[model samples]
Target: MKLTILGSQSPYNTTGHNCPGFFIQDNQTRLMLDCGSGSHSLLNYPNDLQNLSIILTHLHRDHYNDIYNLQYSSFVFHNQKRIEKPINIFLPSTPAKIYEDILSEQNSFAKYQIIDENSSFKIGNMNISFCPTDHPVETYSIKVQNGNRTIVYTSDSSFSAKNRLVEFAKGADLLICESSLLKEHGFPEINSHLTSEQAGIIAKEAGVKGLILNHFWPEEPVQKYVDEAKKVFQNVIPAIEGLTINIPSIEKELDERS
Candidate 1:
């Protein structure tokens, strides 16, 4: 499978990047994870808009605002036959207003699938599962598996209840974590986000093969986040816009050598 960082900025876009967004693709599936601010503009044609499946971890504006733009483009572009069908969106079912709003536009641009704390589903060659994270609203951390290779994304969560978080991400091939702040900045008031240190701790405890740190605060230096995470986990990759990573398959590697 391949992972693409469409955007990595935190609450909003910075000088060089957009807000949180990701594009993942394997042989048979293409999925978009989180459509935050500036994602729509970054997600232009021929590169990311064909037969896409979307997963919105929560309805927070920074994680979902670009969905409106996606909906609009889907309608306009499909009318011109640029796309064959409506996009599929798997999203949380709480915060009734957000769920309802998405459902209201289902027939037009998207097909909605309700995701909860314990929801599991399949798409193409991937097996996906959800775990409720420590966030104010109904938020979920997602795990995607294709055979033995697995990727976990910690959308937006606090450091308070990390046991479940660690277990959910255990043994993942890559952990796409949200490090919203530096350690010295202190935690968010609502305890809804993690600092770089906390993100690295989860990655280390979970024993993931690699860590891709993202969802950064715009004002801070990106290297600072990477440096903090590297202190705990050696294989740390900073999430940069348009950066693509291909997961190495052990079986494939063996076959090639033989």
Candidate 2:
């Protein structure tokens, strides 16, 4: 499995990098996770847009802003490529206004699929499950499992004392968590954002093999975030645009063992 960071900045990018968007692919399947600001412009392969599945964690502007661009781009690409199949999009329903506009339009660009209440779905070889997050709006933390590799992405969530989010990410090979708050600043839990320390705690409790901290404030020192997270979880990385990560497959491990 491969994970590419298309954008990692938060709310709005202070840096040149786009907002929170990711491109994840395995051998046969390609999935776009969160089409945020500048994602359409930052797309490395316009042809890949022809056939892809997109999952939007919530309707937050920073998270879904690029959908409009994608719609236009896909439509144009479809005309050029004669692509008849619409892209599959999975998103929450409660921000009814957003989905209404997306689904109301008669376009061949996207097919909207509603994800709610313990929804589990399959796209090619990947099995996806959702857990309700502690965000202000309806948000979901996604878990994807393929073979022995598991990835848990906490789209946007606040600190929870109960540790339900930790349980959701249990045993993941990679935990892609949002670290929107600085430990020095002391964020409000009600705001639905995680501090670097909180992110580390979750990664540690979840027992993930690797931790990628993203959705961060662009102006802050990257090393500060890493240092804070490392206090709890050792294998931590700060996400930057164009960063590519590869998850080793179970077959490789078995081959080495033999």
Candidate 3:
């Protein structure tokens, strides 16, 4: 399995940095975890569109705005006979107006699938599940597993004792968590976002192998987030655009032992 960071900037995009978007691929499947603004420019367009599936954590513009770009691209590809199938899109069915607007177009070239915390699905070799997050919107944190390796992505969310994030991320090989605020910026838990320290605490409690802090404010230094998270969890890094992390599959080892 390989995880690629397409964008990590939050709220809005900046020079060279886009909003939250990630691309994960394992074996035959190619999944776009989110399609935030400016992320479409990073994709391979018609080429990558083949066998592509996308999941939006919520209806926030920063998390899903580029979906329109993708929808347009899909339509063009289908018209040109460059692709035969519509892309599969998984998203929450809330904020009724936004959901209705997204699906209102009859000519759209994407297959929509409504998902919630109770949803679990498989795409190729990867199994995926979701857990509700502490965001104002109907957001969800995603978990994906393949060949005993697990990855959890915590979308925009706040920290709370009642949050199911730690349990959802428990024992994950990689925890891609949002570090949207700095501790000095005031109490983050009271807001709808997590601080760098909060992200670290979650990583420590979850016992994850590594933590990648993302969804940063454009003005802050990425190093700060990394440094703060390291205070709690040593094995932590800041998410960088275009960075690709390769997760080796353990299936071969199991096959050899068998």
Ranking by lDDT: 3, 1, 2
Residue-by-residue lDDT tens digits, candidate 2, 67-136: 8877776777787875567778888987889888877766547788899857998888899998888878
| Candidate 1 structure, TM-score to reference | 0.91
Per residue, candidate 1 scores C-alpha lDDT tens digits across 138-250 of: 89899999998898999999887588989999999888899988877865643678888888899999998778889988888889998888788777777888776777653
* Model 1: residues with Cα > 4 Å off, grouped in runs: 44-47, 188-190, 249-258
Best by TM-score: 3
lDDT of each: 0.82, 0.80, 0.86
Model 1 Cα displacement at 211 (Å)? 0.6
Question: TM-score ranking from best to worst?
Answer: 3, 2, 1
Runs in model 3 lying further than 4 Å from the true structure: 161-163, 249-258
- In candidate 2, stretches whose alpha carbon ends up further than 4 angstroms from where it belongs are 106-108, 249-258
Q: Which ten residues in a row have the lowest lDDT in candidate 1?
A: 249-258
Clashes per candidate, residues 3 or more apart or on different chains: 0, 0, 0
Q: On residues 218-246, what C-alpha lDDT tens digit does candidate 3 reach at each position?
A: 99999888888778887777777887778
In angstroms, the error of model 1 at 176 is 0.7
